[model samples]
Target: MRPRKLILCVEANEQVLSVRKFLLETRGYRVVGCASAAEAIEYLQGALPGSIDLLMSDLQLPQMDGNELVRRAKQLLPGLPALILSNTVTGYDRAAAADAFLPKGACTPAEILDRIRILVARKRGPKKQMPTAEMMPHEMAVAG
Candidate 1:
């Protein structure tokens, strides 16, 4: 199977970006880390349909912000999963665009990786099937 492609939209922080790249690549994901929301949008414009499987972004950004990034990304790739990690805790709701919110200063690298794995697993998991009824009537013989 082809490797899953992921796009990470974050501000112009080399340390954070480096750590994220290391973590994601270690997990076998093809990462395209963008320093700003505008860069991410440019990538989306040229990206193939369904190319980006996941988007992990920092909530606070200089230009467009992670929230807007996610909204636009959803429009481009509806099934794509997103996670918003930020130091500032305002305006991040589980019900909103991001699938998960990670408090930047609070969460460790391991914790962040774990959350990413969980989200990816959920996205790739098999479709749910209805449970079979415990009781069923005997089938009538067909008059073939």
Candidate 2:
């Protein structure tokens, strides 16, 4: 069996963090929840390369915002996928560093889960396949 994907979830609110952790865990993801960007950063620094599959953080965080966290995280692990959540739409533009941005209250739990699934799959990249002899010339070209 494939190993469960590890996610680093950062949010200042304990309640939000707990809910997110529960949601992710029940969905078969192994989540490491943190209450602050600093805490999350510390965890990242100690983590081995490719240990964490995704980074999901709240836009509003103590000391540093989610965008900054994503930027720093990318430096530590390039190509790391990040998702930023916010209660308001005003800061969506600022979350450009993130792979995706979701409005907390506006999006339903299902939507959140769908987005997470998409991001994680994107990080895993396209699946490899052997070009079959039956494949057309154009199809083989694309597959290769």
Pick the lDDT winner.
Answer: 2
Prediction 1 TM-score vs. true: 0.77
Weakest lDDT window of 10 consecutive positions for candidate 1: 129-138
Model 1 lDDT vs. the true structure?
A: 0.71
lDDT of 2 by residue, 1-144 (tens): 447789999999999999999999977789999999999999999988888989999999999999999999999988789999999789799999999999989999888977887777777766542223234436645655
Model 1, range 81-112, lDDT digits (tens) per residue? Answer: 89998887665663278888888888887788
Model 2 quality (TM-score): 0.86
Which sections of candidate 2 miss by over 4 Å? 128-144
TM-scores for the candidates: 0.77, 0.86
Clashes of 1: 0
In terms of TM-score, which candidate is strongest?
Answer: 2
Question: Candidate 2: global Cα-lDDT?
Answer: 0.87
